[model samples]
Structure formats: structure tokens, C-alpha cells
Target chain A: MFNLFDLGKIFEISSRSVKYVFILFIIVLTIGLTESLFLSPEDYKQSHSVRIMYVHVPAAWMALGIFAVIAFLSFGTFIFKNKNFSLISKSLAPSGFIFNIIALITGSIWGKPTWGTWWAWDARITSMLILALFYLMYLLSWRIITNKNSANKISSLIAIVGAINLPIIKFSVNWWNTLHQGPSLKIMGDTTIHSSMIIPLAIMTAAFALFSLLIFLMKFNTEMIRIKSKGLDRL
Target chain B: MVKKVKLRIAFLLALILSIILSLFLILQSLEKDVVFFLSPTDIKNLEEIEKKKIRVGGMVKDKSVSINSNKINFIVTDFKNEINVSYSGSVPNLFSENKGVVAEGFLQDRSYFKAVKILAKHDENYMPPEVKEALGDK
Candidate 1:
């Protein structure tokens, strides 16, 4: 079935988007960091330490968003059973894992001075660790399982099942009494965080989202190349 | 087509079963590790202290706090009820009267709590939502 899923057009689009987003990501991230460090108002209580929110919140948001994307892509794998969906899901794993790690590390660091402890077995922290495990499992399945078809199905299944953690992580603070504060911005209600902090936060979150897309495109390009080389063998 | 349908059923069955089993384990661990916070009223409502660690959060009642050589004593109240809390170590910078505080340790009784650690939030204008709901316009 020489099914090259519109190879030339996809390559052209991904390449162009990757270049555009990478430039945007760098410029936006620099501005976000500069403002976070210098321009944002010092919190009346934590003072300089409260600035950690700019880094921690955006990383946490990206971690959750990227995992949701993986689950969506995995769902696509099952319905379409298309190799392209599987490839995209696999491509997403590394960046998601890195973002998850960033969230955990920054969270721990931020917790020490504010919460008076480095970490606690609170619902929010525990659920996030489970998410990191899911990311690790999805990535490891790709490397350890030799057969490409079986690996694709297995990793997709892992992603699909691992989606169970997403909702738990989102509501962990609300559902249980945890030290981690309730979300700064509620879906419906007024934002509790100050607008000064929100500006840097919005900019930082955008930068992380763009960076995630750039990394996924780069990884997807490599996966496409691998497929093309293997297809050549069949010819 | 019948064979493919049977295979799909088997696959889905396995997936559902494993998910249920994993969920059971995750919840079991959560129960074991979950440290729930209770307000002063909940403390009054409890039959007895279980000796297992628990967290108590509320506003520190005004003038109910006393400091002495690294040891601090305070009353955490939800307007309608209160509990006396004692701690030997440092408290968070925000841990003062009229501020929101969460103390983790054993309850000596319904009226007395011994805190091993004290956590104070940095949000000057904020209280833990649970504390706010429990206190209710107090």
C-alpha cells in the first residue's frame, strides 16, 4: 500500500511553522523572564520569592496541556489507526516529560520558603508525581519495545490509560485539602492573582506553549525521516 | 469481521479491568497518605483523636498568640469554634494573629493541638478556600 500520508505537503507546513514558532518562542520567553525578574511587583508577603510563580505556573500548565494533547493524539491513533497519529504522539513524549520535570523542581523550590517544607504528600504533589511516571512509561515503551507496530499500539494505549491522571491532577487541590493553593485563576470566577503578575504569567505561558510546539515539530520531522528510510527498504 | 469484533471486545475488557485495578491501588495509597485538614468546628465534632497526623487550618484569633523562646502557642479559630495549638519550632513568616494558618500534627484533644510544623500562606489578602468556606463570613 505505499501510503505516504501526503509527505511533501506536511513537511513543508511543519518546517515553516517550526521556524516561525521557534523565533516567536525565543523572543517571547526572553521578555517574559525579564519582566518576571524585574518588572513584576514584589508580593507583600513572600516578596522576591513570590516571583517563582511565573516559572512554576507556566511549566505546570504546559505539562498538563501537553499530556492532554498526547491523549488526544493517542485517541486519534485508535480511531484512524493512522501511523501519523502514532508518530505525533511519540514525538510529544520528551517535551512533556521535560515540562513535568520543570514543574516538579520549581514547585519544590518554591514550596520550601512559602509552605515551610520542601514537599508534602498532598493530593496535588502526589498526583503530579504519578503524571511524571506516566510520561516516563510512555517514553520507555518506545525504546524498549523493538517492533514498531506493537510499540506504537502499546505506547498509544499507555497514553490513553494515563489520561486518567489528568483530571485528578487538575482538581487535586480542590477535591482534597492540600497545602498547594487553589488555582490562581478559576475557570468561572474572578482571578485572585494580581494583574501585574498575570501579565508576566500570560506571556510566560505563551512562550512555553510555543516552545512545546517547536520541539514537537522538530521531533516529528525526525520521525518522518525514519519512516521514509524504512519505506525505501520496502521499495 | 466477527473475529475482529471478538478481539476488540477482549482488548477493551482487559483495558477496563486493568484501569479499575490501578485506580483501586491509587485510591488506596491516597487514603493512606492523604492528610486532611479540619477546622476547629470539625475538631469539636470528632469523637476522638486518632493519633494519626492531621492538619488544622483557620484564622489565628487576635491576641490568642503568645511567643516564648522559640516555642509559640496560639488559638486557631473559625469564628464559631477554636483550638489551642502549641509549637516549639519557627513558624512561617506570615503566621500571626488574624492570618490564615495550617498546623500539622496530633490533636492532644478536642480543645488542644500540638503542631509539629506550621504553614502560613503568603497571600496577604487570601485565606485557604476551605478555611473561608468553613468560617463563612466570619
Candidate 2:
């Protein structure tokens, strides 16, 4: 028997992680919101609308990063053939999708004031939309499929397959006729944005990431309750 | 159970192979669709200017921009080749003469492009990675 999916052990550890979430979220909120509203300089061109970057960029990062995490967790399911990985993936899905929607909505809000249009068929936007659809479909598979074993197996496959969009989403602006600007941060080069802006953005990203952890734990607990009700341990 | 394990392994291996093959084919086709937009010099080097929409990126060619009330005209050059672009819209605030810009639309001919969208660099001295890469050692 595979012990990786042992529910009791997982819960014991996760509840410990939960203890830190509250304090982390408070810190997350204070740093980004305060800096964004106060310390950050106004864009010489975009002006105050530039503040949207503090939210939009971080949310988009969560959207992509969390989906990658889901896919990685799904891969673990296949390797270990354990239900725990699927549960984690399922728990992660809603938060990832929520962030994806936030990114798109914030992006459109930012676009209207800056890019002169709320929507475009630019490659980056198109790819991100596709990614959101992939997330939706992954969640739907888990909902629509009734058999626990088959549902878990199929959704794991879907999650892994959908990961094809990850690289595309990352490279779309670079590889296509996109109006979206390429990333300001690069591994090999200097950060393009003003140093004043980076702090707020980093804080926002950390806040969003912490918020995801809070949601993930709640969802994981729900999944645990679900597994107990189903009584799959007797199998 | 041992026999079931062997069968499952075979099935999964096949599934992974097929997925890999399909992804390769999809990306191969997407290769044609994702232009990442072309450089001005790439536009100039095209054998025949197709009717399909295309994107061109380059500097705004210092002093080549002409602003009218509605339509604006400018020259986009990669320092090697240039294409004259005509756009009808409010120009982006960062749009100036000599900064990097990418325009998307159709090529009227080899030397002229009619653009529907104009994108300018976002931050100060922040060049799009594509533009910087295309510019090479310069």
C-alpha cells in the first residue's frame, strides 16, 4: 500500500502550515497595498493607472505559476499512482482559475486606460485565454466524472497535457505578433521597471502567493472531508 | 495483478508517445502562425509581400514622423532596411521618433505598410526583447 496518500499525516502537516498563513497574509497585504498606494512613483506616461501593474502582474504570475504547480502535482499522481496528488491538484485548481480570471480582468482594466483598448487578439492574451480554458476544462473533468478512480486518472492526464500551454504563455509575446510587452524582468538582463515599482510588485506577488496557500489549505481540508465521507480507505 | 501492471505500462507509454507526436505536429503548424512579428529588415527581405496581415518592428526613424489630425505616417527602420507605415488612431504616449515600435497590419507593397495597431516601448530605455534580439550586437 502506497502511504503517500495517507490522509492523517497530510492533514497533520498542513494544519501546521495553516498557522503561518494568517500572519503571512497580513504582512502580504500591508507591504503591497501600502507601497503601491504610497511609495511607488507615478508613471510618467501611464500615471496612476500604472498602479494596476502591482496587482495585474502579480495575479498573472500566480495564474501561471499555480497551474504549473497543478500540473506538477498531477505528474506526481501518475508516478506514485496515489490519490493524494490528485486531491492536491484539485484543491489547487479553483485558486489558480480565480487568479487567471483576476489577471484577465485586471489586464483589461489596465488596457482600457493605457493600451487604448480593453481586448485584443494579441498572442499573449490569446494564449492566456487558452490557459484559462485549460484550467476550466481540468476542473470540469473532476466535476463531471463520477467514478473517483477514473476521474482522478483522466484529470491527471488532462492536467499534464494542458501544460503545453505553459511555455507558449511564457514565450507568446516573444514569439508572436503581440501588443503585450515582453517581461520587464529577465534572468540575464537588468529589470526594466523603476526600482521603486519593484518592491510593490514583489510584495503583491508574495501576497497573492500566500493567499493561494490559504485557499489551497482550505480546499485540501474539504477534500479530506470528502474522502472520509466516501470511505475509500476500506477498499 | 502483475499482468495488469505490464499492460498498464504499455498503454501509458503509448499514450505518452502519441501525445508527444501530436504536440510536435501542433507546434510545427503554430510555427507558421506565430511570427513574433518580423523586423523591418525581415519585411524588406521577403520575396513577395503577401496580402495576409503581418507585424513589423523597428525604430521610429528620427524626424520621419508626420502627424495629421487623424492619420499619422512614419518610417520604421531596423537601421538596415526601412518600411513606411501609415496609421490612423491615437498614437501611444511613448511613441516618438527613433524609439523602438512594433506595428501590425498589412503590407501595401514591399516599401509601405498600412498598420491597424501601433505599439511603443513601455518603460524608459526598455526595449522589447524581440527588438533587442533582432538588433544583434548593435
Candidate 3:
């Protein structure tokens, strides 16, 4: 049972799967791009500007999803005292941070043409900005701290604290009068988006998820190799 | 080792609970201030009017828009209450009758507004022209 959780085993599996994931990511990405760019009809109002949603929405979702995963793994690290958990969280952070920045930039670009402003201090927008800051602080904490145990503890604490902002971000539009619109796709409610738009959005989201997983596997394998080279049995 | 791990997990949970409580209280206290704009009803229910720059957001009343040489006049309504807004600058492309809008400016009186900027707010529903036509939605 313990061997199932061993770093070597994790590394072997990730390294083996990276190429397959990459090939699948490329295939999905090509289909997703073609669908979103050409097949998906332009918005009745926003027209071609609405195409930005394919990238912006998926990037935002991945950023939020990755951060949630990090926070959960950090909690697991504290309980199990598993260094592997922290290492996995560490590997996940860079992709999450990159996605966060991508979401913000793409959102700003989309906002300029649609909302008539590049940015606003709306509730949803502000909460997302705060989340990006949390990601930044989490990344910086790992770099600034020298001691291994202390670094893991501090970073985990930051992630746990930052988890508080996740619901705030999710509910910001509904909770307050924001310039941003309410969610079109709801898990428990009716989806306002049409099937034509939904198909591309779904495909693009899957492509992004696969891409992030590929990034995670590469980063995780590199960390494991580093540990093995140093002759450490476990993290 | 098990006892130590259990204690650590308990402490982390307590910390999370306390932090959540603090955040809830803070957000509750700052509720009104955090809102991006006030609806017409919200503005009407205010205790006292401040002579400050504020934003009023609502739908542009159907067929209430009138454009002059440079100035444009429109009525913004929340269906229960309405405020008449007049602006001199160009409005966003999305600004039109029966669409959501936010006007930033000063309130001249209970029923009048002087807008410095007009921002069109689109709803979450997205569909192509053909789908909209098929559904007979405007």
C-alpha cells in the first residue's frame, strides 16, 4: 500500500504518460480551435468579439480549478505529513499562475470591446484579481523560504487561507451588483447558452485541462528526477 | 506520530474556521460599499442624496432614446422606478433601447441625471442571429 504512494512509482507513471497526453492535447486543441474560430456562430450582439469567450472562460475555469486542487492537496499534506503532496502542489502552481494571468489579460481584452472599459472594480473582477495575488504570494513563498520543512508549512498555510477567496469569486456576480453578467452555465440550473456555442466551449475547456495536466506531469517528473539524482529515498 | 498528526490537522481546521468567520463578518459589513452600481430603486430608497459622482445602472427604456446634434437623452428604468439621463458624449455600441446600461454622472434631481459616460451591459445569454430569430427573441 505504501509503495503505491511512492515517489518513484508516481514519477514512472507520469513520465510514461506525458507523450500520450501531449499528442491528445494537440489533437483536441486543433479541433477546439477550428470549432471555436469557424464553426461556432458569431454572437447576435457581440459578433466576432464573443469568440474570446472560448479562451477566456476556459482559462478562468482552469485557474480556479487548479487553485482548488492546490488548496486540497495542501490540506492533505498537513494531515498526512506527506512531502509528495507538497511537491505535487508545487508542480501545479506554475500552470495555475500562468492560467490566472491569461484569464486576466484575455478578460481585459474582451472587456474593452464589449464592456466599453478595459477594467472595472466590479465584484467578480476584483475577486479574480485577489486570487491572482494569492497565487503570486504562494509562488513567492516557495522561493523566499530556504528551509524545506518551513517552506512547505508556510506555502500550505497560504493556500489554505487563499481557499477562502474561491467561493467569494464564484458567487461575486450573484452576491453583488456587478458590471459583469451572471453565469450562463450553471451546474444546478438551466444553461442559458445555446448548443452551438456550448460544444466549442466544452471542447476548448477539455483541451485546456489536458494541456495543464501535461504541464503538471512534466514538472512533477522533473522534481522526482531531481530528488532521485540527490539520492533521496522520499520527499 | 499519529497523535501529533491528528493535533496538527485539528489546529489547521480551527484556523480555517476562524478565518472564514472573520471574512464573512467583514464582507457583511462592507456589503453596500462593495456593490458596483445602484439600481433606480436602490437610489430612490436612499436616506440622503450626496452631491458626488455615482453610477446608476438599469435597462434603457424602450423607445425612450432621443438624439440631438450632440446630446442624447434616454430614460433608464428598473421597471419600478426610472431616471432620465442626458449625455453629450458618444455612447457605447451596445447602448440601445431595452438593453442594460450603466450611466456614470451626477443626479440633478429625483428624476433627472447628467451622465458623463455611458456603458452598455450585455446579459449572459449568447446565441447567433439565426437562433435568436428562430426563437423569435429580440
Candidate 4:
């Protein structure tokens, strides 16, 4: 008598929190999209295609951001011997991997029009590829290890080691001259970007963050439920 | 217990340091110059035309295409209008007549696109973004 409808109870627990998050997500998205799309004047150079930045850059940011979170969770599990932290890390893997893939794909698509090439082995590109590989390895490690305790120990170590790649990815462009262009949104001294452009970018970033959080929450809840139901069935 | 606590503190410190470092790098990248791609129509409307290296994209109009030794000549069509394009470098696999392409460089004397590089689609099914934009206009 496993009814899929029973899943609705999961939604009921934090319904208020979800609603508030959703509202905030929508507001952020609206502001970001409007600023980037309508209000921001087209680049004196790029024109309309510059709009793709609203999507491409934020996704790239999140791809890196999620991995950072994963590293922290992995470290916590390793140091504190916390199963909950390990579960959170495991839950985040597939989504983080998917985001990185999306970022690379969109980046390639954007690069074709802008860089005149679909693929490049530049520092940023190469490091991001490595990050994607780390994600795959993390997932594979989870699958291969059958013993729960041993798997947790090994995976935690792997996650910590893989975190080294994050710093390399972040500094790749600066460390080496590469085809991949540097950041254009947030700078230190001189930001020539108009408020119109910045606003949409901010909105899109917020939307991306909310979307990631929503997915994480949903996935975490489902995993918990599955574990609980399996235990009940055993009883 | 004290050793474990110290290790946990160290880990947390490392995490915070990494995040701040990433933020700094991203901010640094934002300061670097960014280039843009443009089509012929965009060039016509642009005010500061001389300063930027813009990408001109369209199709190589049939019959307007010519070749001499190393240089190639052709007219890029936007369906409703067209512009002359000339390039001296190796063309991409997708360069052909009536097919979409993007040329990177600058306009010479407001007449011909003196392309420094040429990019072409790899397959028949693919359309360049500039072409898609133009097609969307109609």
C-alpha cells in the first residue's frame, strides 16, 4: 500500500518556510530578469546576445558554489563522525554534478558565438572539467562501496581531496593566461556596468540560489522518507 | 577530545578561507575586459564603431563569393539585406553559401568586413545565433 500521494505529507512539514522561500525566489527572479532583459541597455558591443550572461554566469557561479558546500559537508562528516552530514553530501552530488554539466554546456554554447570555438583547454575550462570529474568519482565511490561505515570513511576522504580542485578551478584563469574570459559582473575598482545589467544579474543569481535550495530540500526530504519507509517495511 | 576539536576548527577555518578566496578571484575576473559579437545591422546602429572589435555574422551570399590565392571574398546575407565579407585565414568546416557563419574582426571603411577569424557551423542542422536572431526579427 505504497501510495505516491503519501509524499504530500513531506511537503506539509515546512510548507510555510517553502512558501516564504518561493515568494522571495520569485521576487528575486523578477527583478533579475527585468533588469537584464528590459532595463539594461544592450552592451555597446554585444547587443542582445549579452542577455545570455544572465543565465550562463549564474549557473557557473552555482556550479562552483554547490561544490564548495559539498566539500564542507564532507569535511564535517569526516571530522564529526556525523551520518547526517554524509547523507547531505551524498544527496547533493547528482544535483551538483548536473549543474556543473549545465554550466559547461551553456558556457560552450556562449563561447561559440563569442570566442569562435566550442571547446578550449584553457585553465578555467580544464579545471571545471576536473571538478566535473571529481563529482562523478564521488558518485561512483558511493555506489561501489557496499559497507556503510567503510563507504562513509572513504567517501569523506575522497571529498576532502577533491576539494583541492575547487581552489585550482577558481584561480585557474589568474594563474595562467587562457582563452576563457575573466569575470565581468563583480569587480573591485572600476565597475562600468549599468544598474540595469547588475539588477537582472542579481535577480538571476537569487533565482538560481532559490532553485538550488528548493531542489536540495526536496531531495533531502525524499531520501529521509525512503530510509524511513524501508525501516518500517523491515519491521 | 581536544585534538578532535582542534581538527574541526581547522577544517572550518579552511572552508571559510576557500570561500573568500573564490569570491576574490571571481571579482578579479569581472574587472577584465569583455568582447562582444555583432552582426552587420548592429554595426550600422552602433555609435562608437571604431573602438571595438566586433563579430559580423550571416550567410555567404551566392555569386558574391570570390577567391584569390589566399584571400576569399563573399557577401553575408541577412535575408532582407547583405554585407560584403573578406577574410585571409583558414575558414571553419561549416563555411558555405546560404549557411550561417560568424566572422570576428572589424569593418574596413564601412564597406567590407575584414575578418581576422572565421567560424562556421559543423552541421547542416545548426544555425548561428546571429541568424536565429535575424530569423526571429521577421
Candidate 5:
């Protein structure tokens, strides 16, 4: 089982790739941390506590990003009937749900200090919660349906329908008056954030992307190995 | 083969379109949903305050809580300082006296808060950190 690839060659290649990606991840994390923690001045309104935005904002961004990827994967599986695409998408669901959970938790934590409450039914918050729920339902759909074709078809439909929530989540605050504050980094007529803050945020966002990529790749590889092993066992 | 190709192309197109649309929406929402957390003390010092929306956090002072139908009145205190909060809405499961609470709304005439929403602490130990920092200790 372990003798499929040249051991030394595989080790050398994997280690090299891992090192490069890890270094890049570190650099992005450092920039994000430095900008958010040190370089960016305290908000005129929120002061130092506003720094939590660095973490909260990126997590929220990645949550949606991962969902979008999953939705696409689901679509691919539905159209092409590719088992690999479905497996990859299914693998991503748990991670996407985890990120969504993190985003909601961090948002609530940030809300406690800023909004004075832990949660609100404000459009954005409510919609994000719905997004998380949808991800969970998609994951559960796989468990309930043993037939691969049926499971893929149903979950793909769920993913597509749930995609509706993404737009609602984005525009919720604007459509209705909400307690959640408007954008800080970008604005229509004016930008309130300092350059120092933006730099770190960009870095952190990149770091988060890398981190997510690493996780997805590892999960994909593990699934591939499992499938291969099962095939070998049948032989 | 043609049918499969069409499906693949359609899926790819949908994927690209949805991704672009989602990114646009995420960017747009960030403009409004992102904001800073504030303590009760910070809410007090504003001179030109009007209908600006904000959040307030503190422990619900014991015995100061009053309920009349759907309307509820509670005093949030940081042991040394306190603010009166009046809210009329569906309360969360964790709201109670001697626990941390955060109310969202605007200050009315520099004295009372006309809260449109309220959030209760989910646990015993989890007060908003900003509240703890503002209150100094405990």
C-alpha cells in the first residue's frame, strides 16, 4: 500500500511543496497581524477594539468563498456525473461549514463589544446563519441517501437553491435599515480605513486563502488515497 | 457525448457566474455589516449625538429589571457605572439579571436607550471583553 510511489522522490517533492506554501502562509499571516495589530491606528469611533475586524472580516469572506466553490463543485458533479467532483465537493462541505461557524462565532464575539448583544436578526447575520444551516443540510443529505447518484442530484439542488442566500446576505443591510455598521475599508464617497490597516487586511485575507487551499488539498488527497485503498482491497 | 459536453459547459458557466456574483455580494455587504464594538461608558460622552446606531454592553443590575407585557426595562451596570436600557421585543433565551447583555439602538436625549434589539449572554463567564475592559475588573 505504501510502496506505490518512489519513497524518496515523493517525500522530497511533498516536503518541498509544503515548505514553500507554509512560508507563504507565514508571510501573509505576519503582514496581516502586523497591520491589524500594530500599524493600523485605533478607530476614531471604536478605538483599538476595532482591530477584531481583521479576523472577523476575513473569516466571513472565506466562508462565503468556500461555499461558492462548493456550489460550483456540486454543479459539476450534477452535470458530468463525476464521482471525483462529488467527493471533492462533499469533502469541502465540512470545512466550509466550519468556516461559516467560525465566522458567526467571531461575528458574535465582535458584536458583543460593538453591538452590546451576542446575536441579532439583522439581515446579514440571519442570512449567514441560514448559509451555515444550508451547508449542514447539504452534508446531511449525503448521509441520508446511500445511492451516490441520488445523493449528488439532491445535494446539488440544495446547493443551487441555497445560493440565493448569498445575495440576500450581501445586500440585506442595504435593503433594510440595520444595526450592523456599514463598510469601513471601502465606501461609496469616502474610504474611512487607513492604508496601514488595509495592507494587513489584504495580507491576512491572502493568508486565509492559502490556509483554506492547504486544507482542501490535504482533504482531497486523503479522499483519493482512501478510494484507491478500497479499490485495492476489492482486487 | 454532445449531451455530456453541453452539461459540462453549462456547469462551468454557472460556476463562474455564481462565483462572480457571490464575490460582488460579499464585498457589498461588508460595507454595511462591519462595525466596532462599544462599551456603555463610550456611549455617555457624546455631545452632538443624535440618531446614530450603536451597541451597549454590561451586566444586568439586580433588582433593576422590570417587565410589563412585551416591554422590558433593565439597568446595565459595570459595578461602578450604570445605564438604563428599555427594550420591547422578543428576548433571547439567555437574558437574565446578573448576566451580561448587549443592547443595540440609539441614545434618546442623552439619557435612555431606545433599544430596537437585545442580545443576552449565552453563558455565565462570557461577558463582552470590551465591557470588562471598560469596567476595569471582575
Candidate 6:
């Protein structure tokens, strides 16, 4: 099975794609910024402050999406006994953590004028805070643990356990009457948001996704380089 | 290697299961308290209204807001029920008639509330001012 995922081949492919991903990310980001910040119409009620949603919503979606990816990868590491899965999880964490913090901060800033408070212990807000803490714990486990195998075991365990909070975070608004408004864009049903705004939001989300992927590839390449320099065939 | 893998699997399963169990117990206990605020209807149905400060959320009834000097008075309604909220402080910019709002303060009675804070709650709909104007909203 190890023969299926050759580290050198994976490293070669990822390293080569980094430059192209970087270029694509820059192009998409510029378009996203223009659409979100300028082209997107001001919210009828919120006025200009609603532009922050372009960054805040995408950052939040990325944060949640990346964490879900990490959890699945971590689970794979255990079942397949694949160190590569752990390595991919490790590379994905920093970008996820960064987006999580971005989401929280942007949310706080948006909350001030809209919700009339900079911070509220509403279920949605508090659950997101807990998710950030869980991200911190997952990242810290890798840094604090000295043994590679132990770190892999502990971090994967942490991710799987923390995943229970994912559903909790998603349903927090519905389950509890929080200060945060209900979801505007429903996956299965009709969306309340106007298409003019939704187009920009979609572009921004794509740009953020590309940005996270760029970060993952760069970080993964660096890890591969480090392993190669250490004269190790596998993690 | 196989033994070590099995041990890791068992260990991981135990941790995941225990965490889920504990979280479930915690959330179950905290369920009632977890709601950010009660609706006007929720308050009306309560068996006993406590003296402790609480939050009630609902839409501000249209043409129901009144002001006298520095204090503001408004009626919060959940369509089925309504409560009069009186506050001495300023309200959020978004606070308006026919808009969602949450008031935190003491419930004076079943029909009256003395509020300390008024937080405006906006709905999820978003569009430009022009679009709203074109839609014939005055």
C-alpha cells in the first residue's frame, strides 16, 4: 500500500503545482476582492457594513471545511496506518487555524453595529469560539508532543473527538435562538440572499478555497523537503 | 505492528465514544439555558415568571413605538402574543418598527417589561437600497 503513495512523486507533483496555484489564487483573489468590496451592492439595511460578509462568511466556511477535511484525513491515518495522511493533516492545520481566527475577528467587527454588541455568548458565537479552541488544541498537540508516533495518535484522536462539535456548530442557530441571524444560504432549499450578492459571495468563497489550497501545497512541500533532507524514505 | 495498530484503534474508539457521551450529557443539561432569549409566546406560556433578569426576543410591532423624553417604549410581539418593553437607554441603529429585536431586562409582569438593553435583530435577507425602493417598500 505504501508503494501506492510515493513521497518523492507526491512531493514532485505538489511542488510543481505550487507556482500555478499561487498564480490562480492571485487572479481569483483580485476578482473576488473587486466583486465583494466594490461591485457588490450595499445591503439595504446594514448599508456598507454588510460587505464584511464577503470575507467573514468565506473565512468561516473555509475554517469549517478545512477542519472537516483534517478530521477525515486523521481518521484515514488510523484506519490505513498511513503517515502520509497525518502529514497532510498537519499541513492543513495552520491554514485552518488562520481562517478560524479570521472568521471570529471579522464576526466580532460585524457584530458591533448589527447585533449592538462586540461580543455575545450566543450559542452560534460560543460554539464557534469552542471550535477555535479545538483548532488551537489540535495545532498545539503537534508542537508539544516530542515523539512522532505519539503526536500522530494524539492529534488524530483530538480531531475525531472535536468533530462532534462540527454538527453542534452548524445547528446552533436552529437549536437555540441566538443573537446571530439564521443562515441565509440554505444548501437544500431556497436561498434568501439576492443573486447579485450571492455571485460575489460565491467568488469570494472560491478565492478563499484556492488560498487555503495554495497554503497547503506550500506547507506540504516544505515538510517533504525536510523529510528528504533528513534521509528518511517515509514519515 | 499489527498489535500496535489494533491498540491504537481501540484507544481511539474509546476516546471518541467517551467524548461524545460526555458532550451529549452536558448539552442535554444545558439545553434550556442555551437559548439566547425567550420569545414573547414562550414567556406567556411559562408557569412562573422569575424575578431574575431575562431576555425576550420578537419583532417590534409596527406603529407601536413611542418615546417620551429620554425613555423609549415599544411593543414586542411574536404575532400570537405581545409584551411592552420600556427602556431608558439608547437602542441599536437597526432597531425599528417591524424589525426583529431582543430586549434584556426584568419582566415587570406578563404584559410589561423593563429593559436595560435593546439589541436589534435583522433578518437574513440582503439587497441594495435601490432594489428595496424598486420593490415599492416605503
Best by TM-score: 3
lDDT of 3 by residue, B23-120 (tens): 88998999887988889998888787859999999999999999999999999999999999999988878888999999999988778889998888
lDDT of 5 by residue, A77-98 (tens): 6676655567667767776787
Better of 2 and 6 by TM-score: 6
Share of reference contacts found in each model: 0.27, 0.20, 0.79, 0.04, 0.04, 0.88
lDDT string, candidate 4, A1-235, tens digits: 2233444565466444666777787888887777777876665334566677778778878888888888888877777676767767887777678778888988787767655688855568877888888888888988898877778878877777678778777766555445554445434654445555666777888898887776677676666666676752110
Expressed as tens digits, the lDDT of each residue in A1-235 for candidate 6 is 3557777888889999999999999999999999999998998899999999999999999999999999999988876678888889999999999999999999999988997988888998898998899899999998899888888888987888778889888989888898999999887898888889999999999999999999999989888888899854357
Q: Candidate 5 — which residues are off by over 4 angstroms? A: A1-19, A185-190, A232-235, B1-138
By TM-score, how accurate is candidate 4?
0.60
Model 2: residue A27 alpha-carbon error in angstroms: 3.4
Compute the lDDT of residue A219 as modeled in candidate 3. Answer: 90
The model with the greatest DockQ is 3
Better of 1 and 2 by DockQ: 1
Residue B131's lDDT within candidate 4 is 48
Per-model C-alpha RMSD: 4.7, 4.8, 1.6, 12.7, 11.9, 2.0
TM-score of chain A of 3: 0.96
DockQ, 0 to 1 scale, candidate 1:
0.30
DockQ of 4: 0.05
Cα TM-score per model? 0.86, 0.84, 0.96, 0.60, 0.60, 0.95
Q: Tens-digit lDDT track for model 1 on A115-167?
A: 77788778889889999999999999989998877787788888888887898
Q: In candidate 3 chain B, what residue range of length 10 has the lowest lDDT sum?
A: B41-50
lDDT of 6: 0.90
Q: How does model 3 score by TM-score?
A: 0.96
Tell me the spans in candidate 3 whose CA falls farther than 4 Å from its real position: A1-3, A232-234
Candidate 5 lDDT, B5-82, residue by residue in tens: 697678656866787688568747774344223455655665666677876767789999899999999988767667
Highest lDDT: which candidate? 3
Model 3 chain A worst lDDT run, 10 consecutive residues: A1-10
